[model samples]
Target: MPEYIHGGDVYSHAERYGSLPLDLSANINPFGIPERVRQAMHAAVEDCTRYPDPFCRAARQAIGRAEGVPPDWLYCGNGAADVLDRLAAVLHPQNALLTAPTFAEYERTLAGASITFHTLREEEDFALTERLLADLTPEREAVYLCNPNNPTGRTIAPALLDEIVRRCAQNGTWLIVDECFGDFLTDSAQHTLRAQLGTNPRLILLRAYTKMYAVPGVRFGWCMTSNTALIEALYRAGQPWNVSVIAQACAAAAAEETDFARQTALRIAAERQRLRQELSVRGMAVCAGEANFLLFRAQDTALDRKLAAHGVLIRSCANYRGLGAGWYRTAVKTGADSERLLQAIDEIREDG
Candidate 1:
């Protein structure tokens, strides 16, 4: 079994490195938590003594209103990770299809249940293409996809996604689409299939406030599907008060920040382009993804360690399947933070 490693381990790294490093490993909003969300969480502290609404009614309602989906079609979880686990448990898929170099949690969760899964190769830019259709056979119970996928940060083309969904429906396969980073796209609406949730029974849209709202610790995530029975089943599979009061309050306010997503996309799009060019100029193989992050490769597989010496942290793609040594991922943060990372990379290049 391959080891499971994830980003955002600043605490442990800081302890060992003796300095608080700028973490570009986790792709989160550079602006940090919105002001309104901060105030909401502070107010929620007083109510922490009471149990949170297990159904997370208020937060779901806010999300539904914003997304134009019915509240009942939504199910909240401790985080997107929690929701993914619940979906695996409730569906109990005997076999599933996943794209290689994608999120590891899916394989990890399904593996625990002894479920079988197959991976599709992401060659030539790592984009999902028509080749996936041939792999979606009747034997597969489900298909998992990460829009603006982690590590690579590339999104599946909308037209291709439509074809995939239609094919999944034909195969009686559940299409689980994780849009956790969709908000980072400048043209997210065109890419998001949430509007089709009212009609597509096989489509499951997984989303979270963690990245967009900069509240990963709050652990807020929700899923939407037209299949009422499946939604109820997933909710039932979770523990009571799965979303705490603090999370609910913060998520609700964050959801209500109608302009936050737009501003974030605009900011990230510019930075991502600039970062990719700069990295390329430094002789790195930069994958210019549309999300708020970039995946690149240098001749140095030990770049992560070298960057840490400069009080910087980046995601090493060594553990991610389909990627090998010399690959790295970094979030497109604020200009200053990005400059720091670029400076560190420049230093590493000069040292070489």
Candidate 2:
């Protein structure tokens, strides 16, 4: 079988198409980087000769303030993926549980550590239910969950998720929630587990500025937990200076861009709804996700291929364990950009 793939690989597509394509595969903030963050990044170049602060104290402090947690409770990483890898390594679990049709990275990371994991099915539209609680047995060492889960972009309700966390704690299992896309929700605070960190030592909250700040190139993310020993273990397991000087500075500045996140969420919510409605009207089976992207099943054309032929790039979910051909995902871009994607679909349909 082929290896799991991730989105945002526009360079390879550009190479194949002989030109840059409209990249809708990565669910980034379509509003682009904040002006303040851009300036901070430009200023970061003045200090590249020195090694970055391996502890990431300043960045963590900013994030801590924004998240209302102590800086010592957090650990910085190259990205949320790096944190996931570190968690798997520190825990060294023999067995874990995850959801089907979720982020591919979890499987790859767990497998690398020789950790076996089971899967839970969404059944319809990837909706997670309380039945997930049954899988959190004492035998399982850990569980990986993504809030507003990837590809499908659906979020598990906070009450149910809290119950799951309690069960994991009771069963002596670690619950790692990847809230990478949580910032895109207007009511993210109500859904996030950040507040539970102090009470649930086994709870791991993973977050990233890559999507929310539109700074994927920066490769910055962090995790929070009350398990101070786990945080120390993650630090020792990672190389010194895993986060670059530029990334640290950018993240610190990005934290202060409060209005940026709020505005982006508003914009994405509008565009996502618009795209979902349009695709449904066109007879595509659309998943109305709560995040900044939409997933759909369409047979009108080889959606990914047809869109790519017209200089557009979207995610094909056939490789996802629970899904197959005809399933596609596209990021919620600005009105103009999303309209262009819709037009490409129309053009392909008309051509047939």
Q: Write down the TM-score of every candidate.
A: 0.96, 0.96
> lDDT of candidate 2?
0.87
Clashing pairs in 1: none
Model 1 Cα lDDT, one tens digit per residue, 183-250: 99999988999977877898999999999888888899989998999988987896888899999999
After superposition, which runs of candidate 2 have C-alpha atoms over 4 Å from their true positions?
1-4, 112-123
What is the per-residue lDDT of model 2 for residues 117-211, given as tens digits with 9 covering 90 to 100? 34434455678877677777788888888898988888897789888988888998888899999989989888898878998899999999999
Give me the overall lDDT of model 1.
0.87
Worst 10 residues of 1 by lDDT: 113-122
Model 2: clashing residue pairs? none
